[model samples]
Structure formats: structure tokens, C-alpha cells
Target: MLKCDFQYQHADFSLNVELEMQQSLLGIVGVSGSGKSTLLKNIVGLLKPDQGYIQFNQHILVDTRQNIHLPMHRRKITLIFQQALLFPHLNVKQNLCYAEKWLAPSERKFQFDDIVDLLDLNGLIQRKARQLSGGEAQRVSIGRALLSSPNLLLLDEPLTGLDVQLKQQILPFFKRMKDELNVPMIYVTHHLEELEYLEADTLQLNHGQLQHN
Candidate 1:
């Protein structure tokens, strides 16, 4: 299980979150500035909370009282934003390989060939990030994150710019990932429809408070 109880203070607002998640796709829904991103950041160790703790199973991610804050890379968590953010100069395959460098020798790395076939990224593997379409780039982005072998996956508005056709093309990959892999994911989006296809347990957030709607 993934558990977090943290409060982060920003200039505009403070975010207080207390949540527990399990081995399934958990979807977060909120408007912009509703603290959805802030909550995710705290979970993934991107933003440190002023107080409280974060724990994934037996691992203590953050405990402000104990001053135990794990760095982002050591958390075994991967976050993929709306933007692909792949290295502009690197080809698709290279981008996927980049994640391997962070893995420990004992840790498992996702097989590149399997990712290619699952995401239908064969021909585009040689193409640079700048050369791919938005949907294609997002596919590559998901491929790269998956290959990193994270214990938890955090997706931030992953379906943002895609049209209906692209959404149709990409959603099955997410379904396949959930069915075929045990990796737990937190998918965040403002539109409820985007997450319906994933069939994730919905968590609603508004102004830093969590609600089940």
C-alpha cells in the first residue's frame, strides 16, 4: 500500500493530503490550482511538505519530525507529465535507455523490446523526440517511465492534448499495462471522462482537501 499524510505550503495556498492507495490505478480529479499537482509532487518527493510523513509499504519516504526525506531518485517512483519532456537530441530508444542508468544491478529493468511491441513504438524508436507526433511522443514518454521499473507511477494530465483518435489509440496501452504489470499508478486529470476508460478508483481533491465523489 502507498500512504501519505503531508502538508506543503506554497505562496498562494497550503496543501494538506492524507491518502492510502493500493495495487490498482488510482485516478485524481480536480481543477487547475486545486492542489492535485501539489499532492502528487509530495507523494513523488518532488515537493517536501512542511510537516507529516510519507510511506510506501515498509519504506519511510518522508518524516519531517524525524528529518527523514528520501531523495526523488531513491523513492522508486516515476512521474510522467503532460509534456513528453524527452531529451530533444536523443532518439526514442536512447530515451528509454536513459532510465536504465538509474537502476541498481539487483533491480529489474523493463525489457525494451516488450515496451516497443506494447506501445507500437518500433519504427519510431530511431526517431528523435522532436520528430514524433504528440501522441507518439507521449507513448515514448510512457515507455521510458515504465522501463525505469518504478514501484509507483504518477501521471500528470497524461491525456491532455490528444484528440479522440489519439486517446483511443493510447488508452489500450494503459489498460494493458495495468492488466499485465503489477505496477501501481496514480493518474491525475481534470476531466472525469479521461479516467473512465482506465476504470481507476476516483479520488477528488479541492483546495487541498480530499473527497470521495
Candidate 2:
């Protein structure tokens, strides 16, 4: 379970939201700059809230009152950014192995070969990140995150740069990851079609505040 009841004040706007959700894909939908990404950043511990708390699976990840704020890496949450930010210098195999370094020997759950097969990345393993197409790069990015074995995943408009056909092609992989992996996800997008495809429990935001619970 994940619960958030927090507020942050900006120079021109204030974001206040409260939500509770379980292990399921939760979609955050809104126009650009409606606090959708802001809320995601907070959940991932990239941004701190001025008040209230963020609890994940009963662990107090953030609590202003208790002065508790776990660092981004300590949150066990992986974020897939708008751009598939693969390291330009690294090959697909190297990028996938980077996250494995963070796991303890006993805690390492995912195997490299399994991830390559799951993401259909066998052919691209030796290719450099810069050599991949847009869709391929995104696949590598997702595979990298999965290799980390994250408890929660945040996808912030991951399809933004892709064309319609590419979006359709990659979306099934997202669904496969959700169903096969059972990893909870928070997907942020403005496109209603994406929401329809995801069929996720949704929270609507407008003007930096949640309009729907």
C-alpha cells in the first residue's frame, strides 16, 4: 500500500494532495504542468513536501513531523523518465548491469539473461546506447529499471517522444511488465488513449491539485 497526504507551496502555485492506493497500476492524468509530475517526483523522494507524510507498504518514507526523508535510492522506487536516458557511453548489457551493482549478493533477484529475454533485448546487448532507435532505447531503459527489482515504478510520459505506431508497439511490453512482474506502477500522462490502454485506477489533477480521488 501507498499513502500520501502532503502539500508544497511554490512561488506561484501550491500543490496539495491526499491519496491511498494498493499494488496496482495507478494513472495520474492531467494537462502539462498540472502537478502530475510534481506528485510523482514527491512519491519517488526527488522532491520533499512541506507537510504530511508518504508511506509505502507501511514504511514511513517521508514524514515532515518525524524529520524522516529517505534518499531517492533508498526508496526502492525506479523512475523511467520522459526521455529514455540511457548512458550514451554504455552498451545495452553494461547499462543493465549498472543497477545490479546496487543490490546485495543475497538480494539480487533478477538475472541478466532473463531480463534480456523478457525485453527482447538479445540482439541489442552488444550495441551502444546511442545506436538504438527511440523505441529500442526505451525498452533498454525499462529493462534496466526492472533489473533493479524495484518495489515501485514511476513512468513519467515515457511515450512522449514516440510516434503512434511506436507507442502501440511498446505499450504491450508495459502491460506485460505489469502483469508478469506484478510490480506496482504510477504512470503519468496527459493522453486519454494511453489511460484507456492501461485501464488503470486513475487520479485526475488540475492546476496543481487533485480533482478526482
Candidate 3:
């Protein structure tokens, strides 16, 4: 289970939310700048809340009152953004390998070839990050995140800017990934069609707060 009750205030906006979810894919639906990304960042430990706590499967990642905070890496949560954000100096294969060291000793769940095949990146393995198209780069990024065996996977508008043709090409792999992985996921998007595809429960946020319980 995941439990989050936090509030973060910045110069431009404030985010306040409380949620408790299980091991299922949950969609965080909101428009751009609706604090969707901000909420995910706080859960991942990038932005500490002014006063609140987050607990994932009984492990406390943050508790401002207790003065406890865990670094992003140790939280076992992976956040994928709008961009692939791959290492500019590395090839597609190398970018995936960069996350291998973070895997647990028993977590040989997915290997290089498995990921390559899963994301349909067989031909682009040796190519540089800059050489791949938008959809391809995002696929690579997802593969890299999977290799680390994250407990909670968060995606922030991953389909943004891609054309319909590109989205059609890339969405199947996402469906496959969701079906194959056992980890819980929070997919953030502004598109209603994405919800139809994901069929996950929606947690709608407006401005900086959840619209319904």
C-alpha cells in the first residue's frame, strides 16, 4: 500500500493532497501546471513537503514532523518525465546499463535483451540518445526504469508532443509493460483517451488539490 498526506508551497502555487492506494495502476489526471508533476515530485522525495509524511508499503520516505527524509534513490520510486532525459553522452544501451547498479541482488527480473525486445529497441541499441525519435527515446527511458525494479512507477505526461501515429506505435509497449510488471504505477496525463486505454482509477487534481475522494 501507498499512503501520502502532504502539502508543498512555492512562490507560484501550493499543492495539498492525501491519498491511499494499493498495488494497481492509478491515473493522476489533471491539466498542465495543475500540480500533478509537483505532487509526484514530492512523493519521489525531490521536493519535501512543508508539513506531512509519505509511507510506501510501511516504509516512511518522508515525515517533516519527525525530521526524516530519504533520498530519491532509496525511496524505490522512479519518475519518468515528459522528456526521455537520457544521458547525452551515452548510447541507448549504455543509458539502460546506467541503472543496473541500483538493482537489488535478487532482482535479475529483466535483462538487457529482455528490455530491448520488450520496448522494440533491437535496432536502436547502438544508436546515440540524440539519434532516436521522440517515441523511441521515451520507450528507452521506460525500459531503463524497468531494469531497476522500482516499487512505484510515476509517469508525467509521457505522451505529450507525440503525434497520433507515434502514440499508436508507442502505446502498445506501455500496455504490455503495465500488464507484465507487478509494481504499482501512477500515470499522469491530461488526455481523457489515455484513461480509456489505461482503464485505471482516476485521481483528478485541479489547481493544486484533488477534486474528489
Candidate 4:
């Protein structure tokens, strides 16, 4: 449902990739500084590509030739970073509720309660963001992203700093989101074990290019 053929340059580093994704969970494996994040930023419109285009389903998200570049907010793409960037003052429920404002009632694909349940976050609702464990915070972040009803989810090494136990705890949730909730995701990480656990279709991102793993 997504297609990209773009070239982006940053100082001495350049990212040139051509990728097409169907409605499935895709994993991108790369070492540090391999332009994996750069490719994602370009797709999500955080950084405009110097040339080529990006199409999501039938919508043209970027077309440098036509001078068409949709802003990040308008793309309906949600990005989850390595850290759980939840609002410090907001409780878990409140942080999740903030994402609900992105789509109106009729336009929403997933309900807030369903997301909370899917993430197994019912008990954590009343807790402050800073009061949760690493795994709990990540679950809340995932729930918040799902509540936003994004057409495509981009995860940028979301489980980076978590321990093996914590990563194992959260991996099943991602599988459920793919198997049950049917969320299309592009998960980028250096850990191949995570991809193996999810049984995701794998690709290797090396020197700004994509190849079958």
C-alpha cells in the first residue's frame, strides 16, 4: 500500500531507496548509521527527499517533480520512537486520549478501549507517565499510536534500550496488532531476533539501499 522511489542527501551521507510495501508487517534490519531512519523520515514527510516520489495507496504523499509534498500531520502516518515520549504530566489514559483527537468518531478505525485492551493497559490508565516501568511505558506508547488510527505505523528501533525480558514481553503485542488488529507496520531495528520473533518479512538496509535478507 506504500511505494517510494526517492533520493535524499545530507552532508556526506546520502539515502537512495526504492521500496514498495503491501499490507503486511515488514522489518528493516540495519546497523547504526545505515540510513534506515533517514528513509523512514523521508517517507513520513519529516524530511523531504531531494528527488522522486512517494505514494501511499492512491494518495501521492510526495512528488518533487510536481512540487507536491504533504506535511507530516496530514499523512495519517504515526511514528513511535526508541523512547516512550509520552507527556510527562498526563496520565496513561490522558496520553492515549490525546491521540483520539486526531480522528473524529466516525473516521476512527480502532476504539480507545480496544487499543487499551489490546495493549493490556487497563490497570495502568490511572498511573502517571513517569510512574510506569519501561515495558509498561512502551505499551502505553503503542496504545497511543494505535488510538491515532494511523494508516501505516513506523517504528524506529522502539525496543532499543529495553532488556531482553522487556522486549519479549512487548513482542507479542506487536504480533497481535498484526494478526488480530491488522496494523500495517514498518519496523526498523538492528536486532534481527525481534524480527524473527514476529516472523516478519525481512529486508536489509545497507548503505541506503534495500535488499532481501
Number of clashes recorded per candidate: 0, 0, 0, 0
lDDT of 3 by residue, 70-162 (tens): 999788899999989998789999999888876666875677788888898889989999988999999989989888878889998899989
The residue pairs found clashing in candidate 3 are: none
| Each candidate: RMSD | 1.3, 1.3, 1.5, 0.9
Please report the TM-score between candidate 2 and the true structure. 0.96
Which portions of model 2 show Cα errors greater than 4 Å?
Answer: none
Residue 52's C-alpha lDDT in candidate 2? 92
Q: Write the per-residue lDDT of candidate 4 for residues 88-178, one digit (tens) a residue.
A: 8999999999988857799788888888888999999999999999999999999998888889999999998899899889999999988
Q: Give the Cα lDDT of each candidate.
A: 0.88, 0.88, 0.87, 0.91
Q: Runs in model 1 with CA error above 4 Å?
A: none
Best by TM-score: 4
The global Cα lDDT (0 to 1) of model 1 is 0.88
All candidates: TM-score: 0.95, 0.96, 0.94, 0.98
* Candidate 4 backbone collisions, by pair: none
